[model samples]
Target: MKKIVVIALLIVITGYVFAAGKSEAGAGGAVEIKFAHYLAESHPAHDAALAFAKAVNERTDGIVTVTIFPNSMLGNSQELVEQTTNGALDLVIPTEPAIAKYVKKFNMVGAPFAFKDYAATDKLFAGDFIKWVTPDLEDVGLKYLARWEYGFRNYTTSVHQINTPADMQGLKIRTPPDFVNSATVKALGGVSQTIAFTELPMALKQGVVDGQENPIATILTNKMYETQKYLSMVNYTYNSTHLLMNIDKFKSLSAKQQKIILEEAEKAGLAMQKAVREKEADQIKELEAQGMEVAYPDTKPFITAAAPVYEELKAQVGEADFDYYMDLLGKSRR
Candidate 1:
């Protein structure tokens, strides 16, 4: 699918979406930051990004502003990240595994079963963990603003119960291009295919893949229920994401502008997160109403199947860093 660059589109949306004041964008006028992400408007992630935009505009008195494009309206996650690194797009929030392609060690952050829940994720984010991961991104030309939760990832399918690795034998499963996710499917004996988001709906309807795995919010927001049946709350991975900006462009910004931007982004992320946690049951109920069967498979079996994923991550990020992550996680549970 073609990328949806929101910077140009943001201009078009000014009169319609932003109302009267937005046409002032220019070389030295109000700086319009184009933010790109891959979540539908209805999803909490989009809600947070949009909230950040509104907050930035409000907090900065429009001198420093943000315009958000959700659901890859500014292109897919990869394209957005490239744009951000090139300073063409101001920001992009990418799933850590996708960002892993650029920042190798970051792949460890979202390995299958990485964090138990939001609390664990919050603790990791609040500490020095991300600082340790930042050095890896400097060489890649992108600045890691902060680590954000991608929410808890669950497994879903159109067929049988996936309580054990054997149950998934030979099933055609669609997964994101993350190595850990791909490996998990392979470990469980499924024929894993890395499919792009825009093409997933068609792929499902055409039976190109028997099932896919994603958070409840993603599955529902993407309307996968129309194409799939079984929803397994595997909680296999709490796929965290990173908000990134161009290294040079971020360095060029005034300290005040940078402060306002990141602080507002954090505010937006927190709001979005709280909303998702609150709406979890609602999303689950909607899926059931749509005739999709939802089940919380005994998670131990799924966790057991995911054991090797961590070791693989360790191999990528190094044992020291992997051990440090687990150590922090262990502390967080207490």
Candidate 2:
């Protein structure tokens, strides 16, 4: 009787230990990936993320599933990247400048007027840019997946219309905490004020800054039109959001799983680009209807004024990498 009781107790203890040791992969070995981004749910990026998640699930045959956290639910852009780097999160979508803080060469992407148009952007991305930058990301525990569109940034002001570089003088413009952004504003004669995106709407509403720059969709979706009275289609700099995954988390997947993720990421990124392009005209029209004045100043003067920014950036990002990027841009031009 004593032996029988001891055997039963041991069996219970063994079962409990096994249960506690089970991985978060859950039953049948399905892996759950956590993805977070700071874009609003109404934005095209959110839709693209959902499509990517769905495609991955189907392609992987349920072996992998993705869960999304939108609108800074997890944290702001920089915070999200930090979480991903530390393996606290599996994936994140952050702006190129945010990644530039970790990888200096990325600042080349912010070169004023680097891209002539959408076709040029397509060629740049389709070429060796990703291959060139992947190793830097891997060194920092990140895997570059794809580049999603953030569209060309434009200026919106409450105090004055920005028709030329001279018009920008002394105007306080809110910019992201990025050197290139601040440099661009300062080079064009505006006083650059650094602010986080999560705090921008309130900053604009409270008149913390006289004006700000963003894609039209952001202005419309975030209702910046309420606080801003003028919109200038400067198209000064094009920005893209990069999708990245934790390096270890990505490597742990099977070869086939890795292939599926890469393929789906590109497809979803294309979808996001398409959506933004399709909606841009209507978004501007809607903003106009909301009582905001729109300006289509000839960008030639603005581009010329921004020339010094390129040299400044080259000095910061190193001439070698900057020239390499310029070579790629030259090849990308049609």
Candidate 3:
């Protein structure tokens, strides 16, 4: 009788232990979030986004998981931005102009010749500017968690070597829908039109557009080299992406969980920045190998053409604010 009682108690305790373990494991094993961007899997930006997801998952011990939707799997950049604003998407990494729809101030970063180079670009993301930008993201239902550079913009075309502002005149250029970018092309005396990135190759082949600008990493990864004959090295504006999370979705996590996720996200962005700098030489080499006539153009003329934008920015935001952004621009050069 004593043996029977002991056996029954042992079985009951074992069952209870299994049940508790299962509950805990099931409850804390996964937190799924969507991260959207419009770059191919092989693109540096995509790789960086993946690195961010990997870093976050590792740091959080599988408690937080990100589902990266690259190649515009979720939708186009514009559609993704809309989803993010309406809370249909959890996170998105969009270009500077995309954010201008909601937070116009953020667009200041994209001014022509905005950053002198990568080091200055890093300063803008690291200092007081980030603090000011974060709240603006929240105002639009998104939270800016991190900023990462995608390198400087490089121009490419099949018919011409665009070494001067005059070379761009009368050229049909594919540009982002943002007025600022179109304004940029206008200032250069080019005809600017918005084209979806996925359809850009067709546009080029069909002569619907003359050329476009992108990072060398992007021009190579998308195989734009096949359609583009000229790769002009116009180190114009440095394009940076904002890693934004939907505020409501982020608020669903426990405070401790949120803190961990944010810390890990910063790590992911830093890793991406490192990847960009390190892989740049290889990326450029790949483009040149793929039959691209990579021209090292003097950007002085292009920079001069964009001088009018400073006056336009002043009109919209007043001289004081415009000057403030330009001050930031100068810092980027240093």
Per-residue lDDT, model 1, residue 198, is 78
Against the true structure, what is each candidate's TM-score?
0.87, 0.90, 0.87
Off by over 4 Å in 3: 1-30, 316-320, 330-334
How many residue pairs clash per model? 4, 0, 0
Instruction: Give the Cα lDDT of each candidate.
Output: 0.77, 0.89, 0.79
User: Tens digits of per-residue lDDT for model 2 on 1-334?
Assistant: 9999999999999998766434323333678899999989999999999999999999877768999999999888888998999999999988888898888888888788787677778899898988999999999999999898988899999998999999999999999888788999999999999988899999999999999998888888888999999999988888889899999998877667888899999999999999998999999999999999999999999899999999998888898999999999888884
| Comparison by TM-score, 1 against 2, better one | 2
Candidate 1 minimal-lDDT segment of 10 residues: 18-27
Best by TM-score: 2
In model 2, which range of ten residues has the least summed lDDT? 19-28
Q: Which stretches of candidate 2 lie over 4 Å from their true place?
A: 1-28
> Tens digits of per-residue lDDT for model 1 on 177-216?
7788888888778899989887889999999999998888
Query: Taking the tens digit of each residue's C-alpha lDDT, what string does model 3 give over 167-277?
Result: 888998898777567778889988998998888889988989889888877787888888888888877766777788899878876666677668767777787788887
